[model samples]
Target: MEFRCIQDCSQCCIEREYYPSKKFGKIGVLILPEEKERIEQLAKINGLKISILPRIGISEEENSNPTKILAYQLMGIEPNGNTCPFLDTETSDKSPHGGFPCKIYNKRPLACMTYPLIESEPITLD
Candidate 1:
């Protein structure tokens, strides 16, 4: 079987969930460390306000701040953390698949490119 996005459905881009727990709040689009700077630049170029937080990190010592961050999350725009900041909600333009267009579609992060397929036990869908 093949997997494809539903036409006129932007559910994946429009909704976020609290990962690990609610205390961490709704997790945003996963952005790899290498993509962080570019994402920030894109946001700046588009005149968008964004919040990026560390999603995964590693440290040389225990209980110490991460010396290197592995991943970051591009937070949503609403208070409940729904809707991607780059979803182009202001415009009426739709994506080729009939969903809201991504402002940075061609330059989207790797995580966004590989959605519904995550590296975990048994390689489950997210």
Candidate 2:
């Protein structure tokens, strides 16, 4: 079997969901530690305001503040946490699939590149 994004569908980029639990609020596109600065720069160059939060971190001790961040998340623009800031919603231009194109598609995070393919009890596309 093969997987492909449905034409005219940008649900993956436009919709957000609470993960681990709602207490943590809606999760965003995962950005690796190495990609953090670059992602921030992309936002800045595009003149877009973005919110980034630590998604995973590591520390020497348990329950202690992380000394190093493993990954970060690029939050959405909506108050309810929908629509990635890099998604070109301002223009009528569309991706090859007919969905709204990502402003930073070429430089999108690895998570975005591997999206819909998640690891779980039984690995599957979301």
lDDT of 2 by residue, 4-119 (tens): 75533566677556776776667888888889899999999999999999988899999899999988888988766678898888778776767887777778888777667765
lDDT of 1 by residue, 1-126 (tens): 466755335666665557666765677989888899999999999999999999899999999999999888888888767788888877777767668877887787776666656544555568
Determine which window of 10 residues in candidate 2 has minimal summed lDDT: 1-10
Q: So what's the TM-score on candidate 1?
A: 0.78
How many backbone clashes does every candidate have?
0, 0
Which one wins on TM-score?
Answer: 2
Error of 2 at 37 (Å): 1.1
Clash pairs, candidate 2, are none
Off by over 4 Å in 2: 5-9, 20-24, 95-98, 120-126
